[model samples]
Target: MKLDIIDLNLSYGSTKVLNGLNMQAKPEITALIGPNATGKSTLLKCVAGILKPTGHILLDGEEILDKRNKELREMISYLPQEIPDLTTLTVMEVVLLGRVNSLSWKVSEEEIDQAYGVLEDLGLDDLAPRPMTELSGGQQQMIYVAQSLVRNPSLLLMDEPTNNLDMQKQLEMFELIKGVTAEKEITTLMVLHDINLASRYADQIVVLRDGKVFCSGPAEEVINEDIIQEVYGVKSTVHFHQDGFPQIVPLCSVRCLPWQKRKDQGLAHQGSVDFGQQN
Candidate 1:
């Protein structure tokens, strides 16, 4: 699937969220990255049909912006940032819920097998019978990802999928997602805060700034020192790994508030400035 966003716009009352946002995502891992409040999550919600935004959103040249919620849910699988606490449900039950649209009064054997297949793929098959509340944050996160995958969607949208995961789990999850995306030819769009991870995992990186696309392309074309400084207001060194992915080494913030202002406000001493305070 190929997703095209044309002249997209969204707002919360008077505050605009997505302003004329445009981007193209194909059947590959495309990372949507930016600083906070850049509309990265908002865009994903819009595509998932959780939020309505004025625009032309086309899936392989078919307009889907006006599609009904049930219709859109069939074509797109969305994993939100916050993991839901489903204490009453087991991992298997949660995973099966992904196919809720197709489920009848009795869940067929085929649906159970399909759900198990996704769990096995994610190495969570053993956790199928366990209560969701008994698992750790990372384990629950993985189960939600499994839930999303069980939908067998053409387009997958994940918001901070690796939020609660450790370093190893994060790597494992990304590798799994990338492998599945390539194998199934699913259009995957992920909202990621870790730019280095995005560069390493994403086939294409889309940088959003203030509700619009700042820059987007292959990591090599978009991940550079100038972009880092401009988009993130941080000074960083960009180095390529042996596998040809860009690794970012952040040094310091270029937009940190002045020392005098911090001192005058009694937030810091005269000689020391708070790097946490940004313009």
Candidate 2:
């Protein structure tokens, strides 16, 4: 499943969010990383067909921009950044809803089993009967992931799928995502804020800046200190793991030194004024 973006342009009212964006997503996990308002989320939304773009989005060389909603739903699964509160449904029921697009009128026993299998695979079997409203944010995140997987989509786009989880839960989420993606060979693209997490899990990384791609390639090629500072405006040291994955340790904001210089000059000016007054 090859996903290709060609001269993609998207706008919200008058402001352009994605400007001539181009990418070819591999069959493995690809991480979309950038600072705020750089179109990370917007790019996912455009590809998922939630927000229409003026350019082309192709799946396996077929144009997907003109596909019907049902057809698009069958090929792709998109999880938004904010998980809505499901007050009326249990965890199992919420996951079963993923099968709705493929189902006819009545739900089948095989579909029920499939949903249960997904929940159990993600270790959410214990919470199956529990109401979604009763679960923690991390627990709900797991359930939403289960819902996304139940559809068995060829393309999975997740927007910050691990927003509020603790460190351990975040690791678990990434492991589960990577496991399923590799096992199913799903073409997965996710918006991630943490550069280290993206480098660890992504087969390729795309960095966006000011509604355009700054640089994109394998983690080692794109996650250098210079690119990090250029894209994110932060001074970072990138180290490679023994397995050859990149890790980013942010030192400070690049603007921090300039701000400190201005502060010192202000103090010096005040001292000169005080000395003149004393004289």
Candidate 3:
């Protein structure tokens, strides 16, 4: 499947969030990375139909905005940044909720099996009978991820999916997501803050700046010292491992150029300072 976002625009009352943003992704994992307030989450929301935008969102060359609610739900699954704490439910019950649309008067055996199957795949089967309140935050996040997967969505939208996890859990979650999404050929768009993690795992990377795509391509093509400085305003070194993935070692934030500081003070300079060598 291919996702094509064309001339997309969104706003919050008067303040614009996304402005004529265009992007394309194939059936693979694509990581959206940018500084704060760049509308990464808003873009995902528009695609998931949680928030409406003013342009065409096409999946496999067909427009999806006009589709019915059921069709839209089948096509996409979204996990927001903050998942509400519903400790009263069991893990099995929570995951079964993903199939609420397909359920009738009684929950079927096949649905229960499907929910268990997904939890097992994520190594959370042991927690199925446990109350959600008894598990750690990372464990609950995994349960929610399994719930999203049980919907069998063609496209998955995750905003900051690794919010509360420690380093080990984050790695485990990414490995699971990569394996499952690739095996099922699902198109996933995720907003992530860790540049190194994105470089290591993402099949494609989209860099957002000022609510626009500053750069986007394969990881090696888009992630470099120059782009990092330009888009993230950070100095960094990028190196490739033997596995052929880029690894980023961030140095420090880019210091303000002399000309910019002078300009801020309402003064003009005869010669401009070279930001390239400023750091």
Global lDDT scores for all candidate models: 0.92, 0.88, 0.89
The alpha-carbon deviation from the true structure for residue 201 of candidate 1, after best TM-score superposition, in angstroms, is: 0.9
Order of the predicted models by TM-score, top scorer first? 1, 2, 3
Best by lDDT: 1
lDDT of 2 by residue, 196-245 (tens): 99999999999998888888998999999999888888898888999899
Q: What digit string (tens of lDDT, one per residue) describes model 1 on residues 1-279?
A: 999999999999999999999999999999999999999999999999888999889999999978889899889999999766676788989998898853345788998999999999888899999998899989999999999998989999999999889999899899999999999999999999999899999999999999999999999999999999999999999999999999999999987477757767777565756679698
Q: For model 2, where is the 10-residue window of minimal lDDT?
A: 267-276
Which is the leading candidate under TM-score?
Answer: 1
TM-score of every model?
Answer: 0.92, 0.90, 0.88
Using lDDT as the yardstick, the better of models 1 and 2 is: 1
Give the clash total for candidate 2: 0
**TM-score, predicted candidate 3 vs. hidden true structure:** 0.88
How far residue 164's Cα lies from its native spot in candidate 3, in Å, is 1.2
Ranking by lDDT: 1, 3, 2
